[model samples]
Target: MDDVRLSLREWLILKDIESALRRGRRIGGLLRTPRRSIWLPTAVGLLVAASGFLMVAGIRTSDPAVIWAFAAVWPFALLQAFRLLCRWTTPHGISVKASR
Candidate 1:
């Protein structure tokens, strides 16, 4: 790296590119962060399944309260699913511990 000389303008541009990459990585990490937790995903999965059951019951009986209950649970389930999807879409990589 020392063998290569960059002009002041080029150095600034390189620094900008590096910062942009760092910011992008941080955002990606935040988006995929739910996978790092155990209970969150488990709860989301349970909620999704329960919501499905609720919807079926509401449909079979044509009950207003049960339909409303389904409406309430469905949004949360969808949000959690979206969060979970982020982790699934993230590419796996070789992770290493940082040196002390």
Candidate 2:
């Protein structure tokens, strides 16, 4: 096991492969998104809008309602975070541009 260290070139090649896989996954996701998939965001928007209305109407137990609203918004937040992290760690000038 002590003699199994990867050389610099080997490490670079492995890194390149990993970056390529990430880019491929992103592209696949983009290509696979159907027009009907627009409904997901629209639904989420409706939930957010309803939440806002509930809050504005001074409904009782709005705290729980607001918490549910945050939960609904969380997936988008996490997706953005993952995208940011992937953009940060991946090599530049190959697949995606560096985040400013």
Candidate 3:
């Protein structure tokens, strides 16, 4: 390349672009975090709540089928709840390995 030089205005613009690219990686990582998406957690919470309702109905009416249904669903619901809890409770800095 022939001698290349950036005028003051072009240099400032390039500096801004570099800064933006530096920040983009952090933004990308945050977008990947589970907390940003509400649907999955909402669904899990609904499942756990529905399981509680089923157990209550089973006890109140002495229904074996309702109790069995609750049993069948409870494990998966609770596990999802636990995993979601762990993920949400973790500090974003630690989870994303962010410096700032």
Best by lDDT: 3
Please say which candidate is ahead in lDDT: 2 or 3.
3
lDDT score for residue 64 of model 3: 90
The CA lDDT at 16 in model 1 is 88
Sorted on lDDT, best first, the list reads 3, 1, 2
lDDT of 3: 0.81
Predicted structure 2, TM vs. truth: 0.33
Over 4 Å off, model 2: 1-62, 96-100
Task: Give per-residue CA lDDT, model 3, range 3-39, as digits (tens).
Answer: 8999999999998876676579656555444445787
lDDT of 1 by residue, 51-91 (tens): 99999999999999999999999999999889778766766
What stretches of model 3 exceed 4 Å from their correct place?
1-35, 93-100
| C-alpha lDDT of candidate 1 relative to the true structure | 0.79
Query: For model 2, how big is the CA root-mean-square deviation?
Result: 13.3
Clashes of each: 0, 0, 0
Q: At residue 44, give the lDDT of candidate 3.
A: 96
lDDT of model 1 at residue 69? 97
The digit string of per-residue lDDT tens for model 2 on 1-100 reads 8888999999999988766765795554433323333544555566556556655544556587666766666566556556555655665444543544
Local lDDT at 41 for model 2: 54
Every model's TM-score: 0.54, 0.33, 0.57
